[model samples]
Target: INHQTWYIKAEWRGIDLVPRMLELFEGHHEYPVTEKVRIDVLRRFGYYSTESNGHLSEYVAWYRKRPEEIARWIDTGSWINGETGGYLRVCTEGRNWFETEFPQWLAEAPKSFAASERSGEHGSYIIEGLETGRIYRGHFNVINGSTITNLPPDAVVEVPGYVDRNGLNIPRVGDLPLGCAAVCNQSISVQRLAVHAAVTGDDRLLRQAFLMDPLVGAVCTPPEIWQMVDEMLVAGEAWLPQYADAIAAAKARLAQGKAIPTRTGYAGAARLHTKTIDEMRADRVNSQRNAEATDKAKLRPAAAKKAG
Candidate 1:
């Protein structure tokens, strides 16, 4: 897929099975860390105006609207500085710094991982039956509409699986907690509509997808959602050959009327200015580390010590 489409993966993995995994493995879990990750992701991804445009602001607004609920989700013990299994700076207060500075470091000082045997980040998957019929237990990201049992059959899902000579086998999770399933289903609805819209170039369905999106729907009026979809399609028209006829129609509609009033230059609520190269140079070691690190949010002991 093109770089234009990479943001889908970057943005869509919200409120995943980490909570469920915690419940299964550890017997109980709170959602503070998960909630922090969600909020930080919104702030981080929202800062990319080229990727998210105005949608980031909508997400921030939605979170802000539910301050009491979000506060309730917070668990102090789940917080961390330089440790795994908890919230680090990048997962919390320093999210903007990581989001803003890390990309700049990557673009300016590219690092090659080709020679590395191990990296700070890796996905969890189980390999089975290489020598014996041993089933190493871990989670695998796979298409899971049927396995999940609660979500739509067409939805992509991540579930626990094992890879054997027969290839990967996914087991039914039975049902997620009702609230979790409900949340997943809502997002899946938008995703399903989006896939159909992209394949068929049905602009109406595309608009419906945007309308059905949780944050967008919560924050934007119907007229605003309609107009936003039109603008997004027109802005992305070059990469959307399937939407040729739809693009023309959108162009005509956009041309015929004055747009609804919107905050033209509104930065997201939690946005931070990207660090300049000169400013980064002042902290050369940190900048260099950021440049080389595959996990941009990996805990930094020195930085954490300084912060303390």
Candidate 2:
């Protein structure tokens, strides 16, 4: 959506997606895109954005602002359209249900282990093409060398590639639009910071990574971000053994009663209260569809024209 949105928008919006895209906000129009965040991104950075708006909005500094503005972005049409913490809530519930009920269900399950056909995933198809010497073209996330001249060499870039007996080969695609590369570069910085923080257990680096996050930085001051990290570490202590010392320090700080100011009761821009099982069952079909779907929306636009 962002790629196509950027191509069309950038063709006319100017090379930089930042200030130029802002022109879109002042007026009301029947814009064609379903994800509003992408439009906000183009207006801010002069490039297209990616991922569903729900997850994608978390990675940027805009859109998820004050509580009032947040209400505008929150849509209950479906989870992926822009539900807060949608992926985490869904996956966690799935795992919990599996652990609690799968064993019981297994007692009545089929005795034979029958192979099921592959669905839409391409991992097996790629392997088959390599072994059988059949040609395959697919978009891949690979370490960027020169495929995109503007981005960092180490950044993972998604681009077109070919597969066969010779193994995967990347074709030189030259450069993305200047604005596109800039937007991607920002994400690469965050990715690198996260990877390094995990490998080294560097609390300082972890804190830096939070500061680099688009939404985190946009909505928080340095002190608030620091306090938030401490809060998260203490809350997640069971899973964060590496942050033992950091958590201890955070606890000490809180104990001193000198905590930074924060937006009390702020759930975030598009957060939703978790639905109970009874609430979920009320609209079972649609709820199940939204929860399980990879793509939240499956609508085909009849025609996308600039509204007069």
Best by TM-score: 2
Top-lDDT structure, candidate number: 2
Q: For residue 158, what is the lDDT in candidate 2? A: 72
Expressed as tens digits, the lDDT of each residue in 1-308 for candidate 1 is 01011112122257544324323323323322423433343344431111121222232334433423433323223222212223233233244445666666567766555735644332322332444556555455666667767666766776666766566678877765555465567777777889999999898999998889876777688999989988988999899999999889889999987888777876434333445656766886776665545555344222211243
Question: Model 2: clashing residue pairs?
Answer: 16-46, 17-45, 17-46, 18-44, 18-45, 18-46, 21-43, 60-214, 60-215, 61-214
All candidates' lDDT scores? 0.53, 0.66
Question: lDDT tens string, model 2, 134-246?
Answer: 88888777887997777788777777788898889998877777766666677778778878987777889999989987778887889898898889988999998887888
Every candidate's CA RMSD: 10.7, 6.5
lDDT of 1 at 14: 75
Worst 10 residues of 1 by lDDT: 1-10
